[model samples]
Target: MEFMMFCRMLVEISFYYSFAGAAAAHFGGGETVLPALLLSVCYILCELLEKHVTAPSAERLQKAGRGESGGAGRFFRYLGLLPAVFWLLLPGMAPADRICFLFPFAYLAAVIWRKDFTLSRYRQTDVFSTFWKAYGIFALTLTIFGGSALLETTVPAALVTVAGSVLLLRALRHGSEVWRHRDYQLRSLFETGLLIAAAWALSRDAVLELLKTVAAAVWNRLLVPVLTVVIVAFSVVFTWLFQLLRYLLTLGHREPQDIGEILQYFTGQGEALTETVVVSDDGSPVWQIVFFVIGILALVILAAVFFRWLLMRAPGEEHAAEQVEKIDHMPPPEDRKAGGIFRNTPAHRIREHYRSYLRCFERQGGTRLPSDTSRELARKTLELAKGTQEGEETLNMHLGRMREIYLRARYRQEVREEDPAEMKRQTSAVKKFLRSRPG
Candidate 1:
């Protein structure tokens, strides 16, 4: 979870820094390193404090209701925006530049606290919302700063923007699926892939240049020398064989000439012989036109094939309906009880109650399949109980509430104090239905 938060932070920083840097450059200002660094530190600290300190504290204060004024919390929270004043106080800067510098800090504070006035834990969906907001800022910055050099500026920024967008999309897709299925292994693998892709995207030019240099070095220092030696050896052997053949041909005739003299004679002849060929072009070349047409036809065929494949690959309405039907019929596996002695924690008690609820359905001969998720199990069970004496809506409500608690207990790092009681209430409702149902 911490790693996931870190990845989100990285995505935020990449877009924010690019936008801030571009703006600073456009204004002919100095480096934005200080502001960027401060932004990163503040973001991390805010996330940590919210998750660990502020959120839990607020939850306690609300439950206790010790006459604590929520307004005081709000006042202190706005104090987080106080750092922007430091930029305003710095000397040797014009009013415009100071205001410009102040915007990033103020914007950073606003983005940090925008969703809830009080510091609250961010959800996975919140990450996407924050990303789009940051992307909007980047787009606006580029539009304002990239007036004349828009093409040149946009080229590099587009690469980064596209890469960040792809990361967020992949995370959002996989994160939701993994959470639903409790697929931690798949999540880890996805995180690894995202990290690799991000590293490659950021350092693609350096990596390519390094590869090119290594190839050149190998050609110059290793392959070239080896090839040279092999060529030299082959030539020497060839020359010796040629002299030997000449001597054999001579037989009893005048003594065969030395290899050196033979080589000199050939060298002189080679230097003396010279020839040149002249060709003239007439009008247009028919072969060029023929090849061009062939190339165009090949391209057209490839494009057609690609589009056909894309059309075939897309999921249709019928396919989506089939998937839904499959889920409806999917068998859910029996709930696995927690191993070892149970702790008296809210999270543990929630899990225990959820298991008991599942067992109530299991007694009715509805078994769980390993592939079925908690929600899928609940849905399938709901369908099974549709013909029973209890109303479908009531059972669905009970199952939905229990499922929510089970998921939080199973996956969430922290469970609220009220979760165990909620789980017990839902489980009792389910058990009551089971007891009243016709055998």
Candidate 2:
């Protein structure tokens, strides 16, 4: 919507100044052409700001580790203020303004390219809100122009009307939080841009005013009334249904992202979720179906009543209720990386756990305990001895037999699991394996 705002603002400036200036320049109105050129400079400033805010990752990598004490702080500071600065500076330099015309075209190109090239990177929450705001302004500006709506409204008044439409656009998008998909953020940027362009064309003044007048005069003024009635019906139906669903979920130990869905449902845009469950090869959904049915029934009765009771209780009661319900949730911090093979994966976690268990035999300088028949730690070391991505694959296999022997020894307990005699021998083997393997 920022782009839309930029476009609309440009169009209006063009309409009053540039169009007039062009006519003036044609009849030797040298003064008029300057304003046209000057308007282009305003566009240039917006583009420069956009680029300064751009997050091209490869370039960002150099600055990523710089922390807060660096040139980045100055760049961000200038990015926010430069557009307004250049907009004010435009009128004085006619030649510069002509050059600046290329700025908007270049920005449009980059925005398009980024939409394709780094599709995932800019998939962020703020993109769409800004897009819709732009769309609404463009749509309104087009409407006024098409209808030949004589500026019966003052220019500032018209700007206000467009601004309000943008706010409404924001409201609609903001209220849509419940139905978002993983790719929703990325796709919204392209879709909103396209839709706003379409809306601008439709709303251009000539088309809409004609359509508006024809429907109003010929159809007994029916469109508005019909729209109102339909809106009312949708609001009542969806609002209650969505709310009840959210209430039940809260009752059943689930939390929702936002509650505005209750309002959106009435807008004739109810959303539904389709989820999946994994079933074994036995091909029986029977157990899953049984559990779902019981859960739903319990959800309806117990959840609803509890929801009402909780709503009526004191605020602290709700906090206490939440504590009673939650078991062992993690703190919302950067406590763990998302992907790793250690703790959460099968083989790696088991290997690491065994190694930690064996750390008791360590002697010095990263060397493990000496070689012995205490095959437990020895086998684990041997398993890992097969080099990683950095090393060769060829290695001994008889120590592999040690895996089985260790498994048997661990179960039989013929020897104490941690006996020093066996530890000495196993540690030696581990040291030998480590010596032979590429470190």
Give the clash count for each candidate.
5, 23
> Candidate 2, overall lDDT?
0.38
Model 1 residue pairs with clashes: 332-368, 332-369, 333-368, 333-369, 334-368
TM-score of each: 0.31, 0.21
Which lDDT tens digits does candidate 1 get at residues 215-301?
A: 899999999999999999999999899877888867857456664587899888877674334466664779778877796466446
Q: What is the lDDT of residue 86 in candidate 1?
A: 57
Q: Which candidate achieves the best TM-score against the true structure?
A: 1
Q: Deviation in angstroms for 391 in model 2?
A: 80
